[model samples]
Target: MIKREGYLIKAGLLFFFIFLEILSGRTIFLISSFSFFTTCVLSRQPIRQGRAMKISHQTVVNRIIVVAGLLFSLSEAYAAALLPDKQQKVNQEAINPEYYQGLSPEEAYQWFRDAFSESRKSTELFVLPETEEEISKRATIFNENLQRIIKENAESVSKGESLRLGITAHADLTQEEFQNRYLTLQLPAKRPEVLPELKGLELQQRLSALPDSFDWRDKGVITSPRNQWFCGSCWAFSGTEAVESFHAIHNNMTVTALSVQQVLDCTPKQDGCKGAWPGVVMDYSKTDGICPESCYRHYYSMELSCKKQLIDKCPTHIKVGGYASVPQGDDKALQVTLLKQPVSVSMEASSFWFQFYLTGVFKASHCHTPAKIDHAMLLVGYGRDSHGEAFWLIKNNWGSWWGQKGYVKVQKDKVNTCGISSFAIYPTSI
Candidate 1:
């Protein structure tokens, strides 16, 4: 007895609700069937006296086919939404050892120096040894490792690997020295998704509504990348960067360069050069507020005296209201939080695998497991390649000489690759 118009309106309403429910990560098989049935009912309107509205058998079948096609398309899009594009690709270019093969040991030594042109000018950092024996020893080690690194990349698990084993300030340094300096946090040993019409739809809605990509760098919240040098206080730098980003986002102010020196000089009992927990650094900032870098300079790579007078003397400082730890294994949550501001993060900075990362996403399993977190860096942004591969853009404290301009792209969503998901913490300015 219902009018054809009434049937059409009901069908339309059902379709709308089904759409939202699917977005909330619900299985809409039942809803899909209901929608198809509604369409079928709309198509078979009751016949009138003279003008019989005949819906042939073929027409009903065709309408059902149309509804099925729509449901299938919706299903494809929904799957794409839930299965985030976090895959990584390692470039397969073979190594060019021929360049080094033709050079003599002395020429190779000069080659090393030429490779790092600007570094040699900073003599304090790249000091030439007084003994020729020391110089000869260094050249041998550099050339040996150069070939070894090339061979290792060919067999590495990470695809699209682009590594450069150039002479760094630490080229003459031993393995133990390098490991001691690369400090950061590691992931905890633990590790969900989206809709509007189902249970807990609000949380689901938030997940589905997540933007495909976000970069806090574009928002002017992150400060220029810093260098921790041989100092183990990389954690202090990491925490300070996170605090600055949050302060900028919360207060709508220009990004300020807060002092890692203040954290080093003041955070009681923490070895300034020995490295400390990033959360502990933020805790101190909440209580005492960190001064600007201009006020309390970063001097020694090790812990400095608690220069209470120096901090007290500063006219202005930045403060935060404690810190929050990101869920130990939740990457999507980390990605979501990153959309708001850069986050303070730590992970295993292996001396071997990751020490010479020049370009491309680092997805090596070798860098994931360490005795503990060995270095701290800032999580500034998330990006995807033209091929839909995803990566997390990290800002390191190792000067511009390292990485893609003091930044490295870590693999995203591979169960916390590089310990990125294991230990994440951010401070609040609100």
Candidate 2:
């Protein structure tokens, strides 16, 4: 009876040990430990209470079981330590180019296949709620907005000078009609959360005092208009533009158009092809000098061997800064100032705008709609019509077949309209 009781106690302890191991993600070790423990338990028998007990057999079994469990647990702990942590894995896969670069295309393809297979296997361990309805709603909204954009920007598309595929226009409205309709659209009336307030006189004084010509442009500090393509890398584009302009103004030469591809490929400080903030790019560029267009093309396939050594040209021209903060009612002054120099700006684009060409003049509505604002472009200049209505000179990249040979003029200073205000700027050196 004593021997039998001891065996049962040992079996119970082994079961508990296996349970702990399983809970801690050691499935293989738990299985082995449980099997060994069960065999030890089943092979033992109870001895007569008063008779000499087979103490040696029971003692050896317990010793073997305990030692095996300890060894298995230790091995599991070591393996767990060697495995990459969650954060490490994420960094390795997404941000670390070292892991993916230099591999043959076929090898890279195989790596992705294996990685995705493992990911799918792990995902099956969790239960997810149905997202069908939410997905359907988003699809509907996207389709509706796309159709509206195509219909409204039809004239612009027909002209075929700009990337008019992803933008929208007000249907059946002349530029004047669109402006009038925009004033009545009852959009959100929230005040600008980030701009500084400038009184009217102060704004006028600043505008009047502004130089008629900046030396930066003569130096070649101009940015090429960029198309965001299918990626949301506006933040990268903005940062690159600011830096390129700064280089042009200070160096007393034409602003050398820098490669956005360099920022997209090299800067690990922020999201790559996905959306990133301008501030992050600014910070990263300070330490890592800009790369030339020949070395780094916009697409990965265009990347050439980095034969040109990197140059450490920190921004020495304009005061290095981030985004601009213009007051709510100061759109006119801001536009006037921006017209003096090229500016990089962000806007919400409709899907249809991606397919059509935009020409003539457009009165933009304030960006309060549900559409995601993922596009960025350069503001080349602005002008006023005989009727005293303002228009913005904008450059776009969908080649030279769209808009007015590759540009569009948008309405300026109308509340809740596009081109109401501009964003970041790099002043040209006097």
Candidate 3:
């Protein structure tokens, strides 16, 4: 009877041990090993040594307790390994235009506010309206842009155009406000008497086997686009990018950023935040030489005065020997120049279609002419889309969140779409 009672207690303890192992969420092998070990120990006890067996049973119980404690620690360590570190943060999802598809205007507005406004706490690109009146006004503007997006998509479908438009970061902004704040490229009041014309047998020799598609980015001559914020410093961004590409191409090195801030601060006759011409930015590089970004950091909201201290401290990596034009409105020349290096081009980007462009070959109905070019962008490459429509691949300085990852593909046109082929120029690196 004593041995029977001992066996029952041992059996119960083994069952409890197996139960705890199951609860621990360990592997099948571990559970089986534990069960086998408990069964072996309990079954190995002699029924002849009755009192001694009872004492052994108590010892087994103590051993089981110790094993359970170790298992608990192991399980906890395993779980901790699987969990993400508290210090490691997950990145926010990239903005997706498709999320708004098929939703009503009201629903779309709610979605936009949830996505952008909530993120604004950390991003600072957006701000919640402080007043009820301001909230109402912003909602109205957002809905207006939503309507434009719908109409634009419908037109693309009806016309069988490859272009697409969607709600962008600027969805709530009015065309006038977007233009005034973002489109700050100030063209010269009149054309220069003698435009610096780039001509050489070497350039002609390099143009012989122009590929059907060419991208300086693929060749590792272009850097990621930088955002200009509300500053009209597109001229400096575009010119600096061109110089970087020129230096990389000539020196067989990867492209890196020179200071757009240096150009904005030191370039003569150019308003820092209001606007500057791309030509003057390039000219500044040739004469004064722009420093690396580490030397003069860019502050998009406000332009600081040129500091002699920064110039004295940071050395300029490369200087432009000079710059030359591609003859305004010459698409063919622009393509040929792109074969040699990325070129800086001025364009009109004030239209709502241009401002909210998402992807595909962007062809707008009311795009401005060459004379009305109000924005400067880097012309990086040219290629045809899957639909056989040719496009000029240009990089915008509006940050990675805008456009197709800080780039836009404008339709290639003999008439110079958006004045892209207009005012195109490239720097000659020294």
Candidate of highest lDDT: 3
TM-score of each: 0.67, 0.46, 0.72
How well is each residue in 1-430 modelled by candidate 3, as lDDT tens digits?
7656655655555466555444433333255446445544654542223555446666666556545544664464455444322211111132445676788766766677666542233222345666878767777898788777778878888988877776665677788888888898877766532133334554466467678887778888888877787677898888888888898888898877788877878888778889888878778888877787766654434577888787878865468888877766767667777887898898888887788777788874557543468999999989898989888999998766567878999888546887877678788655
lDDT of 2 at 8: 72
lDDT of each: 0.65, 0.47, 0.71
Better of 1 and 2 by lDDT: 1
Q: What is the lDDT of candidate 3?
A: 0.71
Off by over 4 Å in 2: 1-202, 209-220, 295-324, 351-355, 365-372, 385-389, 419-430
- Which stretches of model 1 miss by more than 4 angstroms? 1-102, 113-128, 153-167, 184-203, 298-300, 368-372
For candidate 2, the lDDT comes to 0.47
Model 3 off-target regions past 4 Å? Answer: 1-98, 101-110, 117-128, 190-208, 369-371
Give lDDT tens digits, candidate 2, residues 39-70.
55554432223346445766566556655654
Q: Give the candidates in order of TM-score, highest first.
A: 3, 1, 2
Pairs in steric clash, model 3: none
Q: In angstroms, how far off is 46's CA in candidate 3?
A: 63
